[model samples]
Target chain A: NAGVTQTPKFRVLKTGQSMTLLCAQDMNHEYMYWYRQDPGMGLRLIHYSVGEGTTAKGEVPDGYNVSRLKKQNFLLGLESAAPSQTSVYFCASRRWREDTDTQYFGPGTRLTVL
Target chain B: LAKTTQPISMDSYEGQEVNITCSHNNIATNDYITWYQQFPSQGPRFIIQGYKTKVTNEVASLFIPADRKSSTLSLPRVSLSDTAVYYCLVGDPRITGGGNKLTFGTGTQLKVEL
Candidate 1:
């Protein structure tokens, strides 16, 4: 099973351009998350959804928006990309189980905003 | 939120055992410790997780002390492929009911050389 897959492995955008990064998981997970990783840093959550139609802000939610219209899909949108948004974005999903909190991540999408 | 602190970098030789420690001073009662590994240009992957005592998996082992203030990730017989950034995260196990946001700090970069 393709645990998690992201669209557009790499992209470049000028400041103020907008784009959406698509994340899809086939594992039927109940929780999905969007995170960004800067150079030499760990991943920080931007937004997350506990289930379909439910989204919440995360540690670094500013300048980013997310939608989880379907259980298997989560999309992260940059309304007005800026140079500070240049980082590698990753999507993750995990099952809602009391015994496990393991999150599976996508390959990641590299974005560069000039 | 429980903040984690780990070494910025570590170096080890192939076939040697490597241990990376992370400290979370303000961990909550319901928090669980988890470790993730990331290679260059790839997404982070779950390595091991535990609440107390020791938990062993095929890839690594997680050791959480009785106090749960710190945890250690042990890698046995490391190889060049084991070279990656290791992240320590603390969070609640339940995701559907809320209050399960993971905060990641700068991870420990493990460099395994031959």
Candidate 2:
């Protein structure tokens, strides 16, 4: 059972280019998130969705956009990729529970901008 | 949104019980402590989370003091496979507007030896 999967495990883009990172889950979770991890800076949230057809900004949503068109899929699109936007991107989902919940993450997509 | 601080790295032997501490000096009353494990070139995976006192699951345990100034992640009988970077996240308890779009700290790298 692929819990969470991200497409294009690795990608390279030029400055000002545009691309989309795809995340899909089979566990029927309602929460999905996108994040980027840089050296020494940990992971910063880019965007998230509580359910299908809804999305919101996270801690570092400046250069990213997200869309949740379906329940099982969350897409992260970079309108204009910059060198600062180059980082390892992760997609995660959460199972609802009271007081506490756990997040499951995908293998991640490494994007390098030149 | 609370800020968290963890060690830069730790060294432990196989089968040893390792405790990684996280400091959240400014933790609000509506904050929850969560931990995730990440290997090289992969997304961070959930380990444990707690609001107060102690909480345990099959993988690890989480301990939070009454003041909520700090939290500890305890890994019992760790193995070499457990050699990875451990991230401490402080998420809002009122995880509203969306699913918990967690914020990850710089994290602590735990190296398990033979």
Candidate 3:
């Protein structure tokens, strides 16, 4: 199985431009998350979804929006890209179970905003 | 949410064993400790996870003391391919109060040389 996959492996955006990053999972996981990793720093949570039609803010939710319109898809949007928004974005999914805490991650999408 | 502390970087040679430690002073009773490894330009992959005592897997081992205040990720017989960033995460996904959030601190960068 593909597990989790992200669209647009890489992207470059200018200031004020907008874009969306797509995350999809084939494992029928109930939870999905979006995180950004900056150089020399750890990943910070951006947004997450517990199930279809449910979304929540994370530690670093500013400058981003998320939607979980479908059970297998979670989308992250940048209304106005900024230089600070440039980072490697990762998407992850996990089956919501007490016994299974492992989260499956996507390869990642490298974004550069200038 | 519990915050994790880890080394910024570590250096090792091939065939030597490596251990990375992480501290989480405020870890809750339901919290679990998990580790992830990331290669350059790639997403973080699961390594090992534990709550207390020790847990061993094919790739690594996790050791948590009875207090659960800290954890150690041990990698045996390191190779150049093992060079990457290792992150220690502490949290519980089953708790709805936190929305299953995960906090990732600046992970330890392990560099292995031949």
Candidate 4:
């Protein structure tokens, strides 16, 4: 099974341009998260969803938005891309079982905002 | 939300055992400690996790002290492939709210050389 897969492994964007990152998980996980990893910094959560049709703000949700219309898909959208948004984006998913808390991450999408 | 602190970097030789410790002074009562490994240009991968005492898996072992203030990730017989940034995360997964959203800090970069 493709645990988690992200679309557009790499992309280049200009200021004010908008784009949406697609994240799909085949593991039927109940929780999905979107994060950005900057150099010399840890991965910071931008947004997350506990289940389908539910989304919430994360630690760094100022410049990002997310939607989880389907159980297997979570999308992160940038309304107005800025240079500060240039970083690697990761999508992770995990089951809702209380016994396990392991999250499976996708390869990551490298975004360059010029 | 609990914050984690770990070494910025560590160096070890191949075939040697490596232990990376993380301190979460304000960890909550129901918080769990988890570790993730990340290679260059890739997403972070779950390694091990535990609440208290010890937990072992195929890849590594997680040791949480009785006080629950700190935890250690032990890697046995490290190899070149083991060179990556290791992250420590603390969160409670049972809460359907924001409790499960993991907050990552600057991880420990482990360099395994021959």
Candidate 5:
């Protein structure tokens, strides 16, 4: 399995510009999450989905939106990119099993907003 | 969600054992401790996890004290390849019911020298 894959490994955007990052997982996980990592800081969750068509806000959900239209895909959209949004975005997913909480992460997409 | 505290950085020589500790003094009863390793320009990968006592995996070991307030991640026989940022996270295992989401704090950066 390819596990988790992210599209557009690198991106650059000007202020107010919008873009979407796509994440796909082959593991058929029931939970998917979007997180952003800033320099010298650990990752903060932006949004997450417990299953297809269900989404919820996380610790740092402002300025970002997410959709889980399909069971295997999660999308993160930046409505108006800001300089503060320049960071590495990671996508992760895991199974719904009660015994395990292990999440598999994608390689990450580096975004630079000017 | 419980907040975690860990060292900002650590240095060790190859072939030596490395231990990174994380403190989560406000951890809840159902919270579990997990560790992840991230290399430069890549997404974080799972290392080990435990609710109490100890858990050993091929990559590392996780030890949770009796009080579950702090946990340690132990890496055996480190090499240059083992140099990376290590993250300790504490959260509830049930994502579908979601009370406390998984959170990552500024991880411990380990630099291994030859």
Candidate 6:
């Protein structure tokens, strides 16, 4: 299985431009998440989904939006890209369990907003 | 969501055992410790996890102290492929207020040299 796959391995955007990053998981997981990583900074959650058609705000949800229209897919969109949003974005999914939060992550998409 | 602290970097020789420790002094009662490995330009992957004492899997071993204030990830017979950043995370399993969402630390970079 392709565990998790993210589209646009690399992207460059001008400030205020809009873009979307797609994440797909083959594990049929119930939870999907979006996170961003910057140099010397830990990955922070931007948004997440509990299941298809359900989305929630994470720790760092500013300037980002997400949708889980399909069970196997989650989408992250940047309505107005900012320089602060230039970072590596990762997608992850996991089985729903009250005591288990083991997540499987995607390859990651590197985005640069100038 | 408790904060996690880990080493910045570590070096080891191939075939040697490598241990990366993480500290979470303010961990919650319902929190679990999880470790993830990330190669350059790739997303992080789950390595191991434990709630107490010891937990072993084919890939690695997770050791948690009785206090649960800190945890360690031990890699047996390290190889060049095992060289990567290791992140320790502590999170609540219940989907309450984004605590279940992962909060990554600036991982410890483990380098296995010949």
How large a fraction of the reference contact set does each model reproduce? 0.70, 0.91, 0.70, 0.80, 0.73, 0.80
Per-residue accuracy of model 2 over A8-80 as CA lDDT, tens digit each: 8999999999999999999999889898988877888889998999999888889888899999999999999
Q: Which regions of candidate 3 are displaced past 4 Å?
A: none
Q: Which ten residues in a row have the lowest lDDT in candidate 2 chain A?
A: A94-103
Give a tens-digit lDDT track for model 5, residues B17-75. Answer: 99999999999887888899999999999888788998998888888889999999999
Model 4: which residue pairs collide? Answer: none
A best-first ranking of the candidates according to their DockQ comes to 4, 2, 3, 5, 1, 6
Over B1-114, each residue of candidate 3 has an lDDT whose tens digit, in order, gives: 898999999999999999999999999998989999999988889887787899999999999999999999999999999999999999886786566788888899999999
Predicted model with the maximum DockQ: 4
| Candidate 2 segments exceeding 4 Å error | none
Give the TM-score (vs. native) of candidate 3. Answer: 0.96
Q: What fraction of the reference structure's interface contacts does model 2 contain?
A: 0.91
Cα lDDT tens digits, model 4, A19-66, are: 999999999888999999998999999999989999999889998989
Clashes of 3: 0
**What C-alpha lDDT values do all the predictions have?**
0.91, 0.89, 0.92, 0.92, 0.91, 0.90
Residue B19, candidate 2: Cα error in Å is: 1.0
Name model 5 segments beyond 4 Å from true.
A96-98
Name the best candidate (by TM-score). 4
Ranking according to TM-score, highest score first: 4, 3, 5, 1, 6, 2
TM-score of each: 0.95, 0.92, 0.96, 0.97, 0.96, 0.93
> Poorest 10 consecutive residues of model 2 chain B by lDDT?
B93-102
Give the C-alpha miss distance for residue B58 in model 1, angstroms.
1.1
lDDT of 6 at A40: 78
Give me the runs in candidate 1 sitting further than 4 Å from their true place: B95-99
The lowest-lDDT stretch of 10 consecutive residues in candidate 3 chain B is: B93-102
Docking class of 3: medium
- Interface RMSD for candidates 1 onward, in order: 1.6, 1.5, 1.4, 1.3, 1.6, 1.9
Candidate 6 lDDT, B25-112, residue by residue in tens: 9999978899989988888888887899999999999999999999999999999999899999988777544537878878899999
